[model samples]
Target: MGHARANGDRRVHHRVDLDGRAVVFQRGAHVGQYALENLSAGGAFISGERELRPGHLVHVLIDFAAGNPPMSMTGSIHRVREADNGVSLAIRFPVLSADQEDAIQDAVLRTLLRREEQAARLPLLVFEPRPRVRQEIEAEIRSFGLPVTSVESLDEAVRELEGEEVEYAGLVIHSATHDRASMEVVEFFARTESLQTIILPEPDGELNDMAKRLSTLPHVSVPRIWSRSELRRALRN
Candidate 1:
């Protein structure tokens, strides 16, 4: 069993406890393979020899097992602590591409679902005004074998949430209009501490301001969703 200790951690993204292997490289040269103790879309904790120091830039290839493709990304060591056997290095991915972020989210979600079989079928609530965007998000969530409740308007989503007794795994909101109705829906979920809220804003649109404001709330993520992969990553987060 993996142990999780978020006692004093102040990370924006939630970390999922997991165990995996990753190949660490520096300057295009192979450094060593280490054991990944915990992971989130933004960062990870790797245990290995205390060779890398804080602020050391490196590329990592994480193997998620079973036939899943390895996830590769560049990051810097944020912190390092001495462990019983070796050292635990906190690696932060300052810049993660949409695909890379999605891969990390997928791996973390898989581990979480596996650990809690009851949550495997948890429903995801999606509110997007655009038909194309709504369909895209619904398809991606369905691909994970989870149920999705997609609505074109914030009012409909709020009605569904209030009417249903189902526990949602997360909520994705993409509003191009960012009208008062949408802000109310965002505020509703913001007050609900149990749900993870993700806002996907259109580039250079009014939604940007709302995204920024909502991002200040706890368990809320505002990722730039200019492309499909980016939207998928935001939804997963």
Candidate 2:
């Protein structure tokens, strides 16, 4: 089972195929076991023996076999339709905490990477305050045939990193107008072993001192982005 979409679908979150089992419950009574077909951060589709009507509040324990404990959540039945084997129940999660959302995203991303071998390479993250510089960097990164994601602020980048399970290959940070708090966040990402981070400073030496301090950090590169070759070499390294 997969996403049940119609013509001209306008879904916000894309669904991923999931193969697992769940224990269904309704009205504080145990119903039966169901097969988890497809899943997204917001909802999932499960096929069960008994027919469950829409608007029925249900609890499910998703067997995410990624070394973590099973995910238990409460949701309501959004819709129901006929399936090949049994009836399918569309479950909609109305509420999710930050940890819960991260767990689901991690599970989904793991499943996708397992299915596709080439998906291990994560996209490049560009954190630039200047709009023109951000656009230029994104274009240059794309020219290298690499996928990139750009964020205007450090907070936005942090949110994206925490909310999604996608790993980042590298980070290009332009810290011209960023405050101390933002610089601290950049340094945190720079020191991460999983990503290669390059810090670009303005011509006025705005971030020169910070760059010098972070020179001793591992996987961190300081480069002048004005020179195309220097920037390219840093990204490649």
Candidate 3:
């Protein structure tokens, strides 16, 4: 059978302000209507009374305003922030057929093009540089049996991630030396497909804040070592 065709010329490459679209947020047999605002490859930003926290999986249905039939898919809320005097969710959709995937990609590209056009006239924000901490951190990563590539710059790290063939199940990011840089590494792995991430607290640094923040992320697997053995047994069973 051929992949299903999306109805009508509802352009997927453009952001349709979903304020009036018939959007539904659902988990299992439960369902509720949500105010869907924007959509892209990253996810849908929605507002709802339901407690849709980050990392919670749900099904979404959207009907284009121009009489196109509804498109539906499963999605996970990856980020949440308060807006419109209410909660706003960033939902990431996975598991789409080729046609659906293309539609989403086209939409995202269009949105990005618009953003770039606007940003061309605005000043870009830059951050302070990350200090050198490769040698000190490499030793700790090695002890975990993970391979190490000690790069002096984020540019090098990005290149390595794009080309490196290392088979790592998880990446442990240390908050040593450079705080912003360490979190940047964590964000990189989190965005990478199929890669798991564990944020290791800075050995010499305080853990109270890190522990609180890490506890909230779903992609983050805690007690990293403990999960490994448990996962193996679960798979076997």
Q: What ranges in model 3 sit over 4 Å off? A: 1-22, 103-237
Ordering by lDDT: 2, 1, 3
Q: Lowest lDDT 10-mer window, candidate 3?
A: 119-128
Candidate 2 displacement at residue 119 in angstroms: 8.7
Report the Cα lDDT for residue 205, model 2: 36
Question: 59-101 in candidate 1: lDDT tens per residue?
Answer: 9998875345788888999998998878888999886655666
lDDT of 2 by residue, 1-237 (tens): 142342113234688877688889888899999988888768888897788889999999888654546899999999999987779999998877667777777888887767554432568899888899899889988887778999997788898666667777777877565677876776776666445777776765346566667656878877654556777777766
| Top of the candidates by lDDT | 2
Query: What lDDT score is found at residue 140 in candidate 1?
Result: 73
**Which runs of model 2 end up more than 4 angstroms from their true locations?**
1-120, 192-194, 203-206
> TM-score, each model?
0.46, 0.46, 0.36
What are the candidates' C-alpha RMSDs? 14.2, 16.2, 15.5
lDDT of 3 at 118: 47
Query: Which is the better candidate, 1 or 3, if ranked by TM-score?
Result: 1
